[model samples]
Target: MDAKSIKEEKAELEIWQYIFGFTPVAVVKCAIELEIADTIESHGGAVSLPDLASAVCCSPSALGRIMRYLTHRGFFELHESTHKYSNTPLSLRLLLKNGANSVAPFLLMEASPEMLAPWHRLRASAAPGGGSAFRAVYGEDFWDYASQNPAVSKLFDDGIASHATRAICEIIERCGDVFEGIGCLLDVGGGDGTTLRYITEACPWVRGINFDLPHVVCVAPQIRGVEHVAGDMFKHIPEADAVFIKWVLHDRSDDECMHVLKKCREAVPKETGKVIIVETVIVEGEEDEYSDTKLALDMVMMAHTEKGKERTFEEWDCVIKGAGFSSYTVKHIGSIFSIIVACP
Candidate 1:
């Protein structure tokens, strides 16, 4: 082919990737729904086509197409000689059967009909005065919709709980110093006290107040050394030696974040207290492993929330300083999010 012709063909090829992206997502969702990974593990981590089809209640021929697609996408493996399929390394790590690192529930939540409805209206949401895509679909914001639908609320809680547990544990492990000398730590916007439970368990010396809204804290389970306090963070935060917020600030605008942060600043003792924040700090155009994931989550925030977003470092600094925090330091724990300590 001529040079110009080759360039045109390459451009077409690259555009096709965007067109084909939804197929893998759909196929993977189907595979997880069928419990394909768990079924394979049950058969000693490998299964033949007929056996797998029978187990998941599909015809062999139809299941074969799914298996072919999944294997090619590297979610599962195909043994050339035996013609059996087994879990790939990626499958084992993300399946619900495994703990902590599993993204199964989160993936299912994102692919759900209710959640996907907003994505369809995303373009309209981006236009001037379009407002939130989620609100457009449900006639209310995401949090309001969750509060009204019990099943959806539980599904989202389960999804976030699965991943947040892992992230919290890593923070306690690597950034233990943040908790040192903290007699009482208030977890702002702590849902159901899960994050506070992990924190108290790790640092027995610390007492925890799981602070959130009345409805959210109402259903929280009892944990020793932790008190579930129901209130609005925007209004008032209970006094404590230190305050910790995990992935909560991202769900607000810069003004809203500063509002919450200023309250956090007030809740602690001005002389010795500090606020700990766990959030993603996006670095634009950086080719790091997690940079893309952070950017993707920023897009999710755009489609799903009014002003929620992941912030860049300078943006974070702006909010921190705007919130009246004098200075702060960030520590990365080898995950998509980082731990930030802001001093009063």
Candidate 2:
């Protein structure tokens, strides 16, 4: 019987770390639901445990424990001597509002009970002919469920806005040229026009049509220089100089994606029209933070969508060519999403 070396013992502990990976998710979800970061921000950037507990209606000891874990997780900074907690850069980004890029709504949506339910069925969802985890739980399409549940719909829309805002801002900052030379831009599955509002704000000259289902567009607020139009992309897309779809295509299978792409192709001009697709391009053999995120998102797709998963560049190439596009150029924008411009 040989004794384990120090390195071997540390390697053995890695499995325990992996086992504990899901613990923070629940803790963070609880903190997010209580608006812990927002409370700290509202308190002029720091607060004592008792004050935070009072603000959020939690017991001092319980809130202190939560804050202890959060501070260790790099979410908050703890001043040990004074016993005050302050927002770290990571926590500031979780603020509900008055923050540059708030990710609170998106995180909250994923943390909600309904969203978590699908994850519970992940194993059964993998069985032959069992269908998606979400369908197994809800017994309906995601869009249909959202349309039926107003509260869920609102959360979803807010999540989309929160999730897309940072990526859109980065794209506009680095790849603003994509908006130029466009007279009319139609945002497919525009999701309350969050993406359009960002784009039109940057390029005021470009008129925009925010297109989605009637239920979705009905809830969308009116934005200057952007019209909310309701329609089905599978059947017809409103004619535009260019069609823009961000984080939309990955929800459908290849055939459905091809159908929408063809519709987009038909909506634009033959000579110079293009469809701007903003999605994850799964680069093969890439092992990095971005790839890790993309892969995790692929699992999310499996749980949430019926037949959707993140795709490699090769998969994207097949869909683009199947849509009858003459050619497409891939631009690695300074964001996780790649911009694929498919020409008619």
Candidate 3:
């Protein structure tokens, strides 16, 4: 009731601004769908509201409101006097024509109804034995739902491939030494063989086996040095000098990952083989932007999959050691993910 107390209360309430922050995501998703970034770029980097709206086929007034919010969020830069808009550094990444590095597909996929619906049931899913919130919302699991819906399936695949193209290219360029002397490399759960193709092309001496579910492998693109093999990873993985599993194990529970790693152990020679895992290893300590993003992804995994989650270094070590690996090394690729090489 006092003036100082009222001021303190108002300051505390400011924290709520970030608590209900879905608006930025929704706005970015809409801009991506409308190709607003690309439109501005195509028009030589700036356009008035009316011109931009005409290009995006929307009402000038409606688009203006959206652009104002986006500009406030730093995604777009608005010229005060001219009312022309240009892409900011943040919005530049949403340009669809940017190709592999463009996150448009990934953002669009995450913002899709099929993906967003799960968050509504997060309370139930977080309960003991409740399983995925996605399942809670859709009656079936995420994978099964995607399998049945062709459009959703393509969106999922394209989104993953877009990210993988950039990440795998970086791995090949910066860490190509990881593949040296490897006679053969098996990419377990390699969807579409995009990563394998990149690896084989980068290291011509290394043969590649693209292994995945039957349905996934059936439509895999033809890559000359990579062989498409269809099978379940939990049951069996093709023999290889080095086994590469990227963005796969995180979709499994500890027990499930242990089973798949056991299969990987069996597939390679005990003395000479190594298994490479690419995944997000949660960094603890300060609440910086990178860690915050990683934490958000952890929630996404929790909501979308049966038992998947982002793990910390200690948690990853426990699973690797439990799978009977004699030694392992962790290499942080960048802020987003890490590479774990485990040897039997």
Per-prediction TM-score to the true structure, in the order listed:
0.91, 0.94, 0.90
Q: Native-vs-model 2 lDDT?
A: 0.88
Where does model 2 exceed 4 Å of error? 1-11, 95-100
Q: What is the lDDT of residue 223 in candidate 3?
A: 95
Q: Write the per-residue lDDT of candidate 3 for residues 1-344, one digit (tens) a residue.
A: 99999999998897786786787788788888888989998999999999999999999999989998888888889998887999887787665645456878887788898899888988866787566788889898877887778788778877777778878977877677999989999999888898988898889999999998787778778999999999988777889998999999888899999989988988889999999999989867755558877888889888889899899988998899899999999887775878899999
**Which residue runs of candidate 3 sit more than 4 Å off their true CA positions?**
1-15, 79-83, 95-98, 286-288
TM-score of 1: 0.91
The digit string of per-residue lDDT tens for model 1 on 43-161 reads 99889999999999998999999998888878888998998899988787565444456777778888788888899888756888657888878888888888778778777776777
Clashing pairs in 1: none
Clashes of 3: 0
Number of clashing residue pairs, candidate 1: 0
* CA-lDDT, candidates in order: 0.86, 0.88, 0.86
Better of 1 and 2 by TM-score: 2
| Ten contiguous residues with the weakest lDDT in model 3 | 92-101
